[model samples]
Target chain A: MEFDMTKPVPETQPWSEKFWEGTKQGKLLIQVCKDCKSKIFYPRKFCPECWSGNLDWIEASGKAKIFTFSTAYDMVEPKFTDELPYTIAYVDLEEGIRMMTRIIECKPEDIRIDMEVEVVFQERGGYFLPYFRPVGKK
Target chain B: MSKGKIAIIGIGEVPTRNMPERTHWDIIYDTCMEAIKDSGLHKNDIEGAISVTPQAQPKIAAELSFGKLPEELGLKGCKDAVSVNAGGASTSNAIRLAEQWITSGIAKAVLVHHVTVHSTIPIPDLINFFARAGVDLQWEYPYGTTYNIIMGLMANRYMHESDCKPEEMASVVTALRSWAAKDTNSFFYGKEVPSVEKVLASALLNTPLHKRESNVLGDGGSAMVIVSAEDAKKMKRPAAYKLGDSVRYFSGTCVMRDFYKVAEGFVVTAKEAMAQAGITKEDVSLWNCYLAYPLAHPLIAELLEVAPQGMGGKYFLEGRMSFGGDIPWSSIGDAPGRGHTGSGVSTACYVETARQLMGKAGERQVKNCKYVYQNAGGGSGFNNIATIWGKEI
Candidate 1:
């Protein structure tokens, strides 16, 4: 029997297309405020702080600090059955905003809050995804 | 800063365990009405509102004002509102937002609501798989870790570092069961308490962490209404005032950090709360700390240096956490107990705190409780908040 899980599969909306593009470049990209001086992640057209319509995309420094993280042993989904006991994290970018991403190339016990990490790029489903490995490990 | 003079004029909860009959809006409406009734205020008195949850978009909940929740509850006049997403910290954030709104003169009174239907929300099995397959899934899901695993790891490390043990952790279950046994409204009401043996014998999801250390799931909604102390004084009933609140974020490299310490954010927020309230750790009589797992309590205690290294045991052994004592703790312990309810547990923590303050906590009420410490965790560990609630704010 397949493991039952919750949450509907997310569908890609048109506005999010660009987000997929930046991942392939091995660079993390997020929105920057045009009117006021601010940076945002997870790509948006306007500034969350100032609500400024003036916004543009900028590449990130590929640096992050592990804010908090978790590990999973249960393969609640079939696609994840083989990857049980993996790690996920909430990486706080040096730029201020936080993004949800996965950590790779490290043991679960090695992950900790405030761990420095750098981003790596990979392609999936014809789209780009941003993941991270320990800064010095790779 | 209403300058610490705001009371929780009303309190409402839709239900915790399960409610198949109610939609998210339906539960929100019910809890809102209950709060309105408790406050003795009409809808028009409410000039502001905050909805905390990602389950329902803020705009949808905002549109709910057209119905009885706001209209009949006398909130048709609300001028300021927001849908703040702080993960588990939503309730405390809601309280802070309400206080700011009232103090800023944006509105006289505000309603803060948090509702969750975890069963209704999707938890993808391949969440980590999808992310690691590289669509930028590095924070939590990449390693295929769920919230439980992360908490369990913390628990494992905490026990390894502290004097507490799995048996002592079982006290949380015993205490919660004892309280739930008394509260007929609780999800675990009438349930038998799990023996320490049972906790140890249970299958381990993460080493040193049993399945019984987490909170369970049930559909529910919670709401609180706040008014100025001046307005509260005019009411026929005595009021519940805003004592103080603080929100803190943690950032540092995991490498240089000590393994035994609680998350730096937890300590910072506790101090921030103390600073804001003009009180010391000694002044807080009721500590309603977050307990997503057993490790959180000890981690916070160790980090804050509030209690000596061994003080964590006294509270854990006595089941003070499960009973909702100062640093009163609750978590859907493991797979056996009430599992994670997502934002629902966040609301439940405040509900328990409010109940204790109002002297409505019945069997779980701590003696002479004057000050309460409530903390909420959120966003894969990036966000946290600690709130200080006092009887005479």
Candidate 2:
């Protein structure tokens, strides 16, 4: 899809800059809270579990399971109408973090709950958006 | 048992409509005049004014935010004024805050009102406005996060976790619409009440959700006069006494982060409200839970223990939520069919339920509606508040 100024894009926060930087390189990074031994995603400044600020980033395996999904057949934001019949899904990564992303390169009928999938990146307005699809597909 | 310290003595509602000719001030004037007239109290009797922030206006909207309504209506001696937003839950918030002002000796009577002017907003932009209400601007909206998409995703997951099928939910729309069609005040009153088959066949707005399966938005408003229990007896109209209520907001971006907690939120409010009222589930003769998205009604039914788990959809299918059903949203039609007035439909539900309890619901009255259970909040996430009401304090 071509870049459109009307469409929404992320305004990367200071804490989330590393995540965006990693996405630009086509790598999926999960933030780990060292104090609570927990993993975080979307980049929190403090650990949600233990409220600890000690954190680190780990590259993920890119594998996930479909937690749930739905396809927009109609009535989306006007700016997104050009890309009709697209799927939005929340996928659970191997690290056990549920992230909201889209499922691409698969028919709506083929997407099912608990379906195996992996992360792939697409360039949108100079930023890589992580989307998932059925595993083992090009 | 929790005491009934407060009661709603008066109500006014302007039927949901496109209403292009009416201005925002006209709606506020009409609703408040009807309610204040019904209240049997003059401007001096009103001590405070509360309103929900409206969504449809120009650069500056809901100008009544700073107790402007009391001033505009010449509410003499009106010392307290404030505006609040909690989405549909804002309706309940207005009433709850009124109770506070009255209890603290700050106000003898409080006027709580909500109004939205959709006529001014372009028709196409209406969906865009409602969709953005529940989404995170940075994280979610850019990825085409429309309200329908969010509701559909929640419904999609609700079906997956509860074994509710798309076909079963069709009956919910049909049953709820029947109630809406019965009331002239409802947006769907003259509109067709689609059959279960038609609902399932309606054009898909989002996967697993049909266009007919959700709610309709319109321009309208509802207002009420709430007073201390002592003053309720002086009113000509029968007051709907507050038996018990539980209100709270779990503020956050998305509930999907911990989806399981959604069930906990539903159960907590319902149980707390019922417990405070010193009543069991069997005591309520009517239910006025908000008709938010497709997922809200059934998900609430099951988790609140009103129905067995995974049986929320079946509960509606059995006609249990219809006019003669066990617990009904049909009496005066709810938000789904009645017309969602943005953040005020739940407020509208307050007016409708008070009407039912006061024996003023005419043709839409529920039999033996002595005690009613009602809920309203951010339908998709953020908050849900539950309350129980009675005919007598």
Candidate 3:
């Protein structure tokens, strides 16, 4: 499927450029605090745990477990109308960070809490967005 | 240091249903006028004014073109007049700010007002506005996460962790509808109360949240006149004094916090407010909880210590929160039945509580109401504000 340019695109900030660039190269990245050794998601410039500005990036293992999820059947933005019954979820990755992502390649009913999955990328709005799918599927 | 000296002497609200003809400022002006008239005080008695709306624009520019509330309302003695935007917690926070002003002698009497015109916006724009208001644009918004989806994710996790069945959650909807049926001002007033089965069977807005579980948006306005305790005794109407008040801000983004502890902020703020009031959980005669969604009703009840953790839904299931029940929570239909009117829902809670304390709530009044606990939060428990109102000092 082609990317939907009409959808909102991530505005990469000075701090988040590295993470977005990693996604473009088909890699999932998370931030690690150099001072406190804490793991972070959504790529913050400073460590929220210790307020430390010393941060580094690491490639994720691409493994995850569904923490929770919800499937939208209605009330979505008009641009997202074509992708009805879409599931948005929070997944606990092997890197010790919980990320908000979309779950694909499985029926909504089949999705369960703590279900193991792995990361996959799909281009959207000119960015390769990382999504999760049930392990051993597609 | 003591906020107990301030009291709410009067409260007013416009009919909280669809009113397409009324402008945003019209509702704000009329609500403030009604509240002032109800207080048995002239407009000149107002010394300060605070306005709360959901819009991101400044208060003066958003509410009226000519001037702020002090000038528009003709308060020549007004010492302070400003606007506040705290999402659903704005009104309660506004009251807290007004209390500080009165106790500090910055103003002898203060007027707090809130109005919303959510119904005037088109569906697509409304959806977009709500989406931006709740989601993190740089990360979550691009992924198509809307407000309902955020609440849906929270509900799913909460139900899984607590083993809360859908029927138990549906019981909250059933109870709220039952309460709304009694209030003539509610949007769902005189409507049939949906059964638990019907609620569960309703169209699923998102997984684990049925259509009826979400609030119905409407246009409405609410205002309150608060003054010092000394001034309150001189008024013709009975007063609801502020026993305690607290506001806490954690994280604006929902994903940054632990989803399991989503209601933790409510617990902290409520505990502080109750401690300040020198009361325990049992001293609360009525609970005017801000029920923006069905899931929140149970979650907030647990956090406020009215019901034990994991038992909030059970309280609703057993009918313990209905009018005349043991807990007497949400006696005036709250946001779900009254229709969520942006930040005005918070002020509406205070309005209903004041009426109950003054023995003015017609049919749904809590008998011998002495102390009322009001709680409101914004941005999925990002900022929690709690207030305790008492009939006696």
| DockQ metric, candidate 1 | 0.14
Two-way DockQ contest, 1 vs 3, winner: 3
B20 in model 3: Cα distance from truth in Å? 0.9
Evaluate all candidate structures by whole-model CA lDDT and list the values in order.
0.63, 0.79, 0.81
- Residues B1-393, candidate 1, lDDT per residue (tens digit)? 424767787888754666655677777778888877888888778888777763333344555433334543456787866777666666677777777777779888888777765555433422332233212232323334445555655565566556577777666566556556555446666678776678777765544455666546566667887887778767746455556666655432221133323366677778887788878887876766665555466556556565567666556566555555445444222112343455556766776677677777666667776777777766545557777777775
Q: Candidate 2 docking: what grade?
A: medium
Candidate 1 Cα lDDT to native: 0.63
* Two-way TM-score contest, 1 vs 3, winner: 3
In candidate 2, stretches whose alpha carbon ends up further than 4 angstroms from where it belongs are A1-5, B58-62, B123-128, B234-237, B248-251, B255-257
Question: What TM-score does the first chain of candidate 3 have?
Answer: 0.91
* Candidate 1 ranges beyond 4 A from true positions: A1-77, A83-138, B54-74, B121-136, B251-262, B304-307, B310-314, B318-340
TM-score for each model? 0.70, 0.94, 0.94
Q: Give residue B92's lDDT in candidate 3 (0 to 100).
A: 76
- Between 1 and 2, whose lDDT is larger? 2
Q: Candidate order by lDDT, highest to lowest? A: 3, 2, 1
TM-score of 2: 0.94
